[model samples]
Target: MTTPSRYVRSKTAALITFPFSGGQPRKGVELGPEALLRAELPKQLEQLGWGVQLDRSIDWDSINNLLTSDADINSLKNPRSVSKASEELANAIEKHARAGELPITLGGDHSLGTGSMIGLNRVYPDVATIWVDAHADINTAKTTPSGNLHGCPVSFALGLDGSYVEPFKSWLPNPPIASPNRVVFIGLRDVDEGERKILKEQNIKVFSMHHIDKYGIGKVVEMALDYINNGTSRRDRPIHLSFDVDALDPSVAPSTGTPVRGGLSFREGHYICEAIHETGSVVGMDLVEVNPLLESEAAAQTIAVGCSLIRSTLGKLSRLISGETLLD
Candidate 1:
């Protein structure tokens, strides 16, 4: 029998449900965590022999604060509320990581990435990130056309120029900085103009759809691992996989905040997670942007795929079925 890898350092996992939606202009995205939980995500993880610590008592009232469109950054919507939610999430994630448990964040939206990564980074300073998404999500407040905080998490986490908002900057001033060089992006097809310039200027590594089409998913992943690990064994470096369900083609994951055409295939999406799991270095993961109310017919499909992706990253499929024999 094959032994399970050491992805969860403490043999325990903390499931942090970030049921928040202040990052974007959407209401239904906040329902993602509940939908995923109702789908038996905690039980599924426990089936993989993990000691799951699920957070059932989420104080939405305490975490949320009143906000208006008026902030230091005028175009940025709900700036104070988004910052508050992110700060709270960061503290929760940090608590789990400090205890040596892997953090599995069921995100309310992509905006939660700011807090998730920040919290994980606090524990592991050298953490490498694999940002899997249809959009680069690196836009700053000034560059974001829609002023949605979801589109600007990457900037906030990286301490980019335009992310210095009032409330976010006050508390998360010295964010655990993940060097731009150590981060890699995959499945990006709809990056904004300013984000494109920032990507080039900062030399952030990216494997867009065109690159994926050329190199294939396997080679692309290999390249991503090599780049982030700096040619060291991937197992030696801590990994943070921030997976947005919209990274997959809308046909595969139709219920999301932003559905882009011509995205990663279902297999491609799973392949990314599976490869990362094989390294046994995934310290933190966030599955975000799953809007169950978007596509009625495809809601179940999207939720199932999201759950399966989580399973894939947690070393679920690395084992064979019971009573299976290898004909050697």
Candidate 2:
């Protein structure tokens, strides 16, 4: 019998349902977890030989109550709410990840990336991260045009320019969780001007749609993994995939808030998860920004894809395609 890898069990996914949308201006992203659950995402993973544990210890009401003040600190909306909840989320994810369980956090927004990575990095300090989104989501307080906290998670995780402020500064650690070298971004097409400058200055790795059109999904994902591992074997490091549904073209996942036109096809999106599962080093993942309040057919389509992608990450796609056995 093969032993399970160190990073995760053939482990249970501690399904953390974050019914939060305070990170941005949207109202329905907080409904993401319920939509995925109603679609039976947990049962689907069980069929793939993974256990599912719903994390109910988090008091989401209290977390939301903290947002009563509409005051923006340093131009960041819902500052206290996002900061306090993220700190709580960090604790929750750290508990599961440290126990060697894969924490598949259903996000309220990409801002949860700030908390999720902090949790995963606390366990695997050298963890590598792959961010799949239409926007770089790296704008700091100074660079953000809309002042949404969701757009600023990446900078907060890296301690980049304009991220050093209260609330975040109080809990977000020194030296931050993500080192610039260990991060990579894919499916980016809507990146802002300020964000482009940071990507250049920080020398981050990015595989935009232009690159994907040039090199194909397989090669782009391969290059992303190679770059994150610094050209070493990927098995030695832990990985966290933060996927925003907007990375899929609007047609593929039309229910998302920031749908982009040119995005990954269904096969291409699933293929990325397959590649990550093949590494067997994924410790945590986040599926964020799914709003089920949109068109009925479109919402259903987006939810189905979200469920499918989550299963792929848990090794279902690889088990089928490569004839690799999963679980005992």
Candidate 3:
């Protein structure tokens, strides 16, 4: 049996799948969690000796109705519904995190990260986040051209002015536990122009493709962890890894809603998760933006990659999943 530790020790993971896709224009991303489940994700985690608490699937009937409930908020699409769903997701994740179980939320879309992070902060107020994504996902409602909430999760999580927080005012108390310095980004390649200004203005630390090309993923992970942990032991802080599968090379993970080329290699992506696991401070995680409607074969590959990413975060070895003799 595993001994209780300061970070994670219960050997239990609360698997919460947000299978609704109102954050973007995509229709099939909601099916991502089911696809992952169909791939036996829970069984794979069980093989790693993790006792899984599978939460009930989200009831999307009411959520979908709320999507068109309000007029656009400064050109933002479905602001009301997205905020409601995020608030609900935050509550669900908060319950598991407070219980000391690693809360793993499968994708509805990346926008849900707002809720996931807020919920985690309620439990570990000092939690640090390593946002792995191809796009910045930090565009505010005013700056987003597509008006898709998926592209604006980081802004909402950071409590930016353009985010819809009034609806969640009663629930999300003292939100945005993550400050500019505490959060870092990896694998960013297609950042928007406005987001670039925000990144520079907020002094957000980002390791774009340029940085990755220079430093390598190993060094990048080390730097990211060091920044978040602030030279302290991992046990002294909680780590929240918000992984968007698009962070991987399109060839590596193509079934995502937004696939950017020249992303992390398959091994590099797993390396990020493995390194986080080694810290033993992982409190919660979100695997989002997986859309199976993109292409059947590519979707399957992306789903496999998504599952592999989650397995790595949960302390499973890469070879255990594919027998590939990659470095740890």
Kindly list the per-residue Cα lDDT of model 3 for residues 30-79, writing each as its tens digit.
Answer: 89998999989998887776898998645567888887565676677887
TM-score of candidate 1 on Cα atoms, chains taken together: 0.92
The 0-to-1 C-alpha lDDT of every candidate, in the order given, reads 0.83, 0.86, 0.82
Best by TM-score: 2
Which stretches of model 3 miss by more than 4 angstroms? 3-5, 68-70, 164-170, 174-178, 231-235, 318-328
46-134 per-residue lDDT for model 2 (tens digits):
77767789996677888878877658886789988888888888899999987778898897788998888888888889887899999
Expressed as tens digits, the lDDT of each residue in 87-185 for candidate 1 is: 888888888888888888897988888888788888888888899999888898778888888999988898888787777887675653847565799
Write down the TM-score for model 2.
Answer: 0.95
Ordered from best to worst lDDT, the candidate numbers read 2, 1, 3
Where is model 2 more than 4 Å wrong at Cα? 1-5, 322-328
Q: Which order, best to worst by TM-score?
A: 2, 1, 3
What's each prediction's TM-score? 0.92, 0.95, 0.92
**Which whole-number lDDT from 0 to 100 does residue 18 have in model 1?**
84
Tell me the lDDT of candidate 3.
0.82
